[model samples]
Target: MKAAIATSYGSPDVIHLAEVPMPTPKPTEILVRIHASAVNAADWRLRSANPWFVRLVFGPFKPRRPILGVVFAGEVVGTGVAATKYKKGDKLFGWTSLMKLGGHAEYVALPETGAFAPIPAAMSYTDAAAIPFGFGTAFSFLRKAQVAQGQRVLIYGASGAVGSAAVQLAKTMGAQVTGVCSTRNTELVRSLGADHVLDYTKDDILAKRDLYDVVFETVGKLPFKESLALVKQSGTIITGSEMPTQMLARLFAGKADKQVKVIGGTALSTAADMKHLAQLSAEQAILPVIDQVLPLERIVEAHARAESGRKVGNVVVEMG
Candidate 1:
C-alpha cells in the first residue's frame, strides 16, 4: 500500500510519499480501500509538534502515528470477524482520530463502531471526506452551546472548514448568523447563510454593542477576554482551540457570566450526525466546499496547503 508517511515531525517537508505495508483490520474493524481523505488543522499541528504539550502525543522525536490523516471516505474492501454495520464493498465516510489516525494511506483499518456512515446516494467521496472534520467539529460545538433559533451568533474565521460548517449549522439551528472573516471572504461567508458578515480587517468585532448570544472562535487568534465581552449577558463564547486563563475563569464561574465554553476534544462521532449531514448534502441544504484536491503522491504539498490557513474549506487527497 502507498501512504503519506511522516518520517519525522517538523516542517511539511518531513511528510513524504512511501510504499508501506497494507494495514489489516482488527476483530471489530474494517479494512477500507480509501478513495479520498481530508486534512485538518490537527494534521499540521501534529506535524509541527507545536504548543509543546502536543509533542508528548506525537512523540518528542517523531510522530507516534506515521500516517497523518483522520477523515476518510472509502470503500470497505474487507471487514473483521466482529464487524457488523458494514459489509465488504460498502461505500462509507467517517473519522478515525480515534483509531491511530491513519486515514492518509491507500488502505486503513478503522473500528466499525467508530464514527462512520454509508456515503449518501448523491455524494462523491471527496465531498464525503470533507464532512468528518469540518461538519463533525461544528456539530459538536454548536450542540454543546445549545444554539437556538432567533439568537444572534457570531463565527470567527467563517470561511474555513469548521467555520463554514458552523455558519450553516447555526442557521439550521435558527440562529441569526454573523460571520467574521476578511474582506475577501465576506461574500463566501454570506453565501453560507450568515445574516451578517464582518471583514475582521476593517471592522471592529467589539465595536458593535449588539451582543451575540453565541460567539464561536475557530481561528484561536482572538483575545479571550476582549472577544468574550462581545457576548450578551449569559451568552456563550465557544472556541475550537484553547482559551486563555481569564476565559477559563469565566467558564468555571458558571452560567452567571454567560457560561463561556472552551472546547478542545471532539464529540463522539454519532450515526445520527453523519446521516443528518448526508441528508443535508443530498438536499443541497449544505455544500462541502473544496479548497484543493491532490493526488496521494503530493501529500506533502497538501499538508503545506492546509498549514497555510488560507484554504477556504477542506483539502482532499485522492487515491489514484
Candidate 2:
C-alpha cells in the first residue's frame, strides 16, 4: 500500500510518499480500498501540531499515528469474520476516529460500527470524501445551537470548507444567513444562500451589535468576546477554534447557559451525522464545495493550499 506518512511533524515537507505495509482488518473491522480523501484543517493541524498542546496527543518527539487524514470516501474490499455491517464492493465515506486517523493511504481498516457510511449512488467519490469534515462540522454545530427558521445567523470565514457548509446548512434550517469572507469570495458565499455577505477586508462586521441569533465562527479565528457580542441577548456564539479561557468557561458553564452562551466546540463525526450529510448530498440540498482535486503525490501542494487559508472549499486527494 502506498501512503503519505509523517515520521516527524513539522512543515508539509515532512510528509513523504512511501510504500507501507497493507493494513488488514481486525475481526470486527472492514478493509476499505480508498478511492479518495480530503485535506482539512485537522490534517495540517495534526501535521504541524500548531498549538503546543497538540503534542500531548500526536507525541512530543514524533507522531503516534504516521498516516494523516480524517475524511475518506472508499470501497469495502474485504470484511473481517465478525464484521457484518458491510461487505465487499460496498461504497462508503466517513471520518476516522481521533485515535484511529489513517485515511491518507490506498487502504485503511475501521470497525464496522465506526463513523463510515454508504456513499449515495449519485455522488462521486471525491464529493463524498469532501463532505465529512466541513459539512459534518457545520451540521453538528448548527444543530447543537438549535438554529431555527427566520433567525439571523452569521458565519465568519464563510468561503472555506466548514464555513461554506455552515452557510448552506444554516440557510436550509430556515435561518437568515449572513456570511463573512474575503472580497474575492462574496459571490461564492452569496451563492451558498447567504442573505447578506460581508467582505472582511471592507466590512467591519464586529461593529454591528446584537445582530444575530446565532453567530458562528467557522474558521475558529474570531475573538471570543467579539463573537459573544455579535450574538443577540441570550443567543449563541459557536466557534470551531478557541482559547483555553474560552474552553474552560464553556466546560464549567455546564450543558446550558442562561445568559449569552459562547461555545468553543467540536463537531461530532458520528455515523448519524454522516448519514444526514449523505441524504442532503443525495437531494442536492447541501453541496460540498470542491476547490481542487490533486493526486496523493501532490499532497504537499494540497497541504500548502489548506494551510494557506485561501482555498474556497474542500481540496480533495484522489487515490491512484
Candidate 3:
C-alpha cells in the first residue's frame, strides 16, 4: 500500500508518498479499499498545525496520525467476524473521525459502524467522498440553527465546500437564501438556490443591517461585531471555521447580548447524516461541487490546491 504521511507539520511539501503496510480489520472493524477521497481545509490545517493550539491536541513535535485525510469513498474488501453491518464489496462513503483518520491511504480500516452510508446510486465515488465534510458540516450547522421556511439565511463564502452545501441545504429548508462570494461565483451560487448573491469584493455585507434571520459564516473570518449587526434580533450566527477568540468570547458572554447566539466547531457527523445526504444526492437536490480531481500520487498538489482557498468546492484524490 502507498500512503502520504507527515512526520512534522509545516508546509504541504512535508507530505510524501511511500509504501506502507496494508491495514487489517479488527473483529469490530472493516477493511475498505479506498477509491476516492477529498482534500479539505481541515486536512491542510491539521497537516500544517496552523494554529499553535492544534499542537496541543495533535502533538507538539509531530502529528498523532501520519496519514491525513478525513473523507473516503471506498468498497469493503474484507470485514471482521464481528462486523455485521457490511460485507465484502459494499460501496460506501463517509468521514474518518479525528483520532482515526487514515483516508489518504489506499486502504483503511474503520469500525463496522462509523460515519458512513451506501453511496447514492446517482453519485460517483468522487462525489460521495466529497460529502462528509462539506455537506455534513453544513447540515449540522443548519440543524443547529433550526432553520425554518421563510427565514432569511445569509451564507458567507457560498462557493466553497461547506458554504456551497449550506446554500443548498438552506434552500431545501425553504429559507430565502443569500450567498456571499466573489463576483466570479455569483451565478454559480445562484444556481445552488441562493435567492441573492453578494460579491464580497463589491458589496459590503455588514452594511446590510438586521437583514437576515440566520447568518452562517462558513469562511470563519466574519467578525463577531459585523455578524451581530447583520442578523435580526434573536437571530443566530453559526461559524464552522476556527475563531478561538470568538469561541472564547461566546463562552463567557452571559452578561453580553442575550438576543444573539454565536456558535462554532466541527460538526458531530453520524451515519444517519450521511444517509440523508445520500438521499438528497439521489434526488438531485444537493450535488457535490467538485473543483478538481487528482490521483493519489498527486496528494501534495491536492493539498496545495485546497490550501489555496480558491477551489469552487472540493478537490478529490482518486486512490484506485
Candidate 4:
C-alpha cells in the first residue's frame, strides 16, 4: 500500500509519499480500498501544529500518527469476523476518527460501527470524500443550536466548506438564512439558499439593526462582541472555529448577559449524521462544493492549496 507520510509537524513539505504495509481489519473493523480522500482544515492543522496546543494532544516534538487524513471515500474490500454492517464491494464514505487518522493511504481499516455510511448511488467518490468534514460539522452545530423554522440565522464565511453547508442546511430547516462572504462569493452563497448575502468587504454587518435568532461563526474571524450583538435576546451563538481566547471569553459571556447562549467545541461525526448527509446528497438537497481535485501523489500540493485560504470548498485527492 502507498501512503502519504507526514514525517513531522511543520510545512507541507514534510509530507512525502512512500510504500507502507497494508492495513488489516480487526475483529470489529472493515478493510477499505480508498478511491478518494479530502484535504481539510484538520489535515493542515495537525500537520503544521498550528494552535501550539496541538502539540499537547498530538506530540511534543513530532506527530504521533504520521499519515494525516480524516475524510475518506472508499470501497470495502474485506471485513473482520465481527464486522457485519458492510461487506465486500460496498461503497462507503465517512470520517476516520481523529485519533486514528490514515485516510491518505491507498487502503485503511476502520470499525464498522464508526462514522461510516454508504455512498449514495448517484454520488461519485470525489464528491463523497468532500462531505464528511464540512457538512458533518455544520450539521452538528446547527442541531446543537436547535435552529427551528422561521428563525433568523446568520452564517459567516459562507463560501467556505462548513459555511456553505450551514447555508444549505439552515434553509432546509426553514430558517431565514443570511450569509456573509467575500464579494466574489456573494452569488455562490445566494445559490446555496441563503436568503440574504452580505459581502464582508462591502457590507457593514455590525451596522445592521436586525438581530438574528442564531449566529454561526465558521471562520473564527468574527469577534465575540460582534457575535453577541448580532443575536437577539435569549438567542444562540455557535462558533465552529474558536480561538483559545474566544473560548475563554465565551464562558463569561452568558453570565454577563444572561440572555445569550454561547456554544463552542469540536463537531461530532456520527454514523447517523453521515447517513443523513448521504441521503441529503442523493436527493440533491445538499451539494458538495469542491474547489479542486488532485492525485494522491500530489498530496503536498493538496495541503498547500487547502492552507492557502483561497479555496472556496474542499480539496479532494484521488487515489489512483
What lDDT score is found at residue 126 in candidate 4? 94
Best model number under TM-score = 4
- What is the C-alpha lDDT profile of model 2 across 150-205, one tens digit per residue? 99999999999999999999988999999999999999999989999998899888
- Per-residue lDDT tens digits for candidate 3, residues 86-117, read 98989999987766889999999999889899
Q: Flag regions of model 4 displaced more than 4 Å.
A: 251-255
Write down the worst ten-residue block by lDDT for model 1: 243-252
Candidate 1 C-alpha lDDT tens digits along 136-245: 88888999889987999899889898999999989988999999999999989998899999898999778854388888888777766655678787677786766345
Q: How many backbone overlaps does candidate 4 show?
A: 0
User: Which rank order by lDDT, best down to worst?
Assistant: 4, 3, 2, 1
Better of 1 and 2 by TM-score: 2
TM-score of each: 0.93, 0.95, 0.96, 0.97
Off by over 4 Å in 2: 245-258
Tens digits of per-residue lDDT, candidate 4, 148-222, equal 999999998998889999999999899999999999999899999999998999989997533899999999888
lDDT of 3 at 308: 94
Better candidate by TM-score, 2 or 4: 4
Pitting candidate 1 against candidate 2, the one with the higher lDDT is 2
Please give the ranking of all candidate structures by TM-score, highest first, separated by commas.
Answer: 4, 3, 2, 1
lDDT of each: 0.83, 0.88, 0.89, 0.92
